[model samples]
Target: MQLHDSMIKEIEKSKDKIIENRRLIHQYPEVGWTEIKTAALVARELESLGFKVSKGDVVISSKARMGVPNQYILDQHYAETLALGYSEAELQPFKDGFTGVVGEMKFGEGPTIALRFDMDAIGLEESLSTGRGPVDKGFVSQIKGQMHGCGHDGHTAIGLGVAESIAKVRHQLNKGSIKLIFQPAEEGVRGAKSMVEAGVLQGVDYVLACHIMANEPFGKLICGANGFMATAKMDVRFKGKAAHAGATPNEGNHAILAACSAVLNLHAIPRHSAGETRINVGTIVAGTDRNVIPDEARLKIETRGANTAINAYVKDYAYQVIKHAGLMHQVETEIEVVGEAVGGKSDEQLIDIIGSVAKRLNVFDEIVASDDHAGGSEDFTYMMSAVQAQGGKAAFFMVGASPDGTGGIGHHTSNFDFKEDALVESIKLFTGIVLSLL
Candidate 1:
């Protein structure tokens, strides 16, 4: 209890700094794989606190990364970050879009614990309404079409706070090591797999991660997350010969027709009796001119299920439909998988630890073990799986962010924002959990 109280004091002292950092990150939002500046900031803060820091390809495997932007896009982000006054030395490690940071500390030989934090913003314009949180607070996103619609900015701040608090109380901890994983590109569920492949969870004995839920009431904490659906994001393209629609329509193979057919058939995929299932064709693009038969078409699609096997069942059936759709239209079909994640359940041991700590803090008004329904996909499942594979226990927890105890704005919307005070509670909870384990 003495050690926990000490950690709480450290977190309380840094409350103002944590809120400032969250607002600062909210101002200059960056999207997945393009978070060069964000990664640098996290790395610098960890270094200042005396943690061994690693960045770039060393923290994330280049070959294993999926849905990465092309070189041109990555170069533009690098240039933009360089112009923002970050030294070439600080920005060089993340030059080619490999952006993530890992801060490590060694104590002796006990349990190795890791905490994961994601750093990326959603692509959305911010609302300029006067009463909106960001607008009223004067920290609205500066970049157009990029905003911290999700609470990752707050998560990053909490992670840094935990690092600072841990450094201050290292002597009171058990003989173990701590790792702070600042990940990128989690919005598309694309980053965690790469980090896991690069050996992030190699020797981990326990791993814990938390997300800020905008809908839940503030001071409410969920000990573990469940019903995470496994999912896959894919890009489908069709190629055909073009010709004048009015003159030689028969000579042209219609790629647009194939894409349309594929969309219909993809949705027609039967649901698995095993559990829930979902499929959506989010975007479709085809044709240059209306007078010409379109020669190319592209689609952005995704599939989800209650678990990995069920997700694969739907994905495989969708593939068959895509192939047949192309054949029906005499067009060539191409498919690329960009992102994927498997469903996972939190370990009961970790859940109990978090629950006990939350009770000790006496801050949370409510504590739940897990969600009732299957929630959306999270790449963190990959990290959880990796640790569990090596006999380590893992759990994904949730902290409420609703300011007025009413569900705030929903995530991924332009008006999305959360209670600033929630940041302090989150830091305290995370810090307490880490100290208890160490």
Candidate 2:
């Protein structure tokens, strides 16, 4: 069945409201897991739409804070972490605020369909350039050093618009249930797994999510992409005796040398010809003094590929590199797997559904069916895995939000931004998906 013209027209009428929400969210950007303010706004909006909203753990509530050593002292020590370069400070807040909201609209008895929207922003500052026009004329993030450079502002607004529009068609959706999930902490790739564990898809029969594409031009929507890369984030540490470098060099096992060797070998991991693979050592810290032998060294590494096998292969190789590097340097080592995401493939059946709906709505030209291997990973992989395990089909679509001919900046970049019109189209596309499924 085609999306009713009346429904499309109604969505068109709400475009202004959608833009307003986008701007409001953009102004008060919140980072992953620390989305308390964003959550409050989302919950309030959902409640206003007459949907039953549950807060604090039922759907989206703060997780218990980690019992780190000297919690109170650590909190005071990292008070300035909201600053751009002080990301480690932001981590604790994210851990504490990492929660999600699930809004459900019931229709007649039918298969349950779920729609997810990530609500967390990245830690990059928005560009203040006047080139993108007036929408960004005075758009500066109120929170210092935090901004929605990743277009999640647009995504959250689109989700709300879809939620509202779908509610308007609740009478016609009597055949099935549509669930709206506002997930938090996507930037660090940590939120979706928790939501999945909380049974967000307990009765879910199908799932769909959309992300704004920065490189694509406005007015276009990408229905199917090859898939996202499977990725793992790891922390590696080396321990050694600390001794004065000038007076007792032989007394310390040099942890810095071990860590450096591991970093170099990590890049030597072979890539598979079957799909893309990547390894990067993003951070390294060691040593307390220049005149002393380093007592400890730490490294943050990430591995990714288009599929699970390659991803696993690289991760295993990474572990070996760290182990041998420590052995070679005579420094004890520890490796911790901090985060992971399985690669995802869009189902052809669902891709076709999105394409057809876009066509009927006269937005088909904006939809492209192509495969992309993004090295970046998403926790949404967990949701996809959970749903697929239950024999449910899933698709993650990409919506273009970049102005024509301007790639803007890549995600996580300080200059990352997008066009507003794409928000309206995304809402309509998602709303149409709910209607079709019902």
Candidate 3:
């Protein structure tokens, strides 16, 4: 009881900082690998908190990265972020699109516990309507076409909050070292493998990560998810000859039609008899004007399945669709696997630990082990599997936050928003887990 009180008190002391960080991140949402602004702030805060910070190529291996933005886009975003109030010195560590931070506190001879926090937003416009989103409060995403639709802004805030909370109770942490891992590009499930390949959890005994609002109402906690599907994100581009549409329709091989065909056929992919399968060509861009045939078309696509084999099956078949669709249209097709993650189940023991800790905190109306299927895939599974392979335990918990007044808003949408107080709830959950382990 005394220990729990101490941790809770520490978290309460810094709760304001948590909310402030959340709002700040919400105001300047960065997408995927272009999280320079957010990462710089994270690095600065962690350093101020006295944790040893790692950045740039130090945290992620270069060759292992997938689905990263092209060099030009990254450079432009970095400059824009710098203009927004980040120092070149602070951004230096992650210069050239290598963004993400890992902060570590080492205790003499205890277990190493790692907490992963993804810090990237999805590409979507945020609602400016009063009460429906942050517009009324002036804390809405300032970046156009990018918003923290998945609650990662809140996740990043929780990471910083946990750092401050635990820093207050450092003396009690005599048993283990804590690592706060801030990952990027989790939207496309693109970041974790790079961190894993860079040896982020190399010697960790326990790894825990969480997300906000998996449809659970406020005050409830889903201890962790199982059945997290394996997934692959692919970038497909088709090139063809362009000509005036009306002047010489046959002279042009329209890449847009080829892309449309691919989209239709990709959806027509046979569902595996073994389990579930999913695919979506989320965005397609082709044609400069209506008068001319589009010579180039690009698509953002993703596939998911119950397990690796199933995901692989869909991925292979997707490539064939792209190939055949282009061949059928006489266009040159190019596709690259930009990101991928293998599915896995959470360790029951780790889930048990989270449940017991949550129970002790008394922060929840109901604490339940997640029987929920993680309807989507997460790159964190890569980190979890890596740790478990070395005999470590891991759990990815879910924190609930049902937005007030508005109906349930699904994630990855413009209207997606959550209760601000959920930041404190997340901090408490993480602190609870940290105390249990250390």
Local distance difference test values of all predictions, in order: 0.90, 0.76, 0.86
Tens-place lDDT digits, model 3, residues 1-438: 134676677777777788888889999898888898889888888999889999888889888788888899988887877786777788877777789799999866878999999999998988887875477777888888998998999999999998887777776556679999999988888888999999888999999998888356888788878889999989899999999999898999999999999999999999999989999999998889989989999999999999889999999999999999999999999998888999877888889988888787787887879755787888899999999999999888887787762327688888888887778878888887787777
Residue pairs clashing, model 2: 60-100, 107-174, 108-174, 108-175, 220-366, 221-366, 226-371, 226-372
Candidate number with the higher lDDT (1 or 3): 1
- Give all candidate RMSDs, comma-separated: 1.1, 4.7, 2.5
* Per-residue alpha-carbon lDDT of candidate 1 for residues 1-438, written as tens digits (9 for 90 to 100): 234566677788888999999999999999999998889999999999989998899989988898998999999989988997989999999988789899999988888999999999999998998877889879999998899999999999989888888888777665889999999999989999999988888999989899898888887888999889999999999999999999999999999999999999999999899999999999999999989999999999999999999999999998999999999999999999899999988999999989988888898899997774746999999999999999999999988888567876588988888888788887777777776786
State the weakest 10-residue window (summed lDDT) of model 1: 1-10
For each candidate in turn, the TM-score is 0.98, 0.89, 0.92
Write model 2 residue lDDT over 296-400, tens digit each, in one string: 999988898778889999999999999999999889999876667788877888889888888877864556864576557777777887898899988888877
lDDT of 3 at 253: 97
* Ordering by TM-score: 1, 3, 2
Better of 1 and 2 by lDDT: 1
List candidate 1 segments past 4 Å from native. 1-3
Q: What is the lDDT of residue 67 in candidate 1?
A: 92
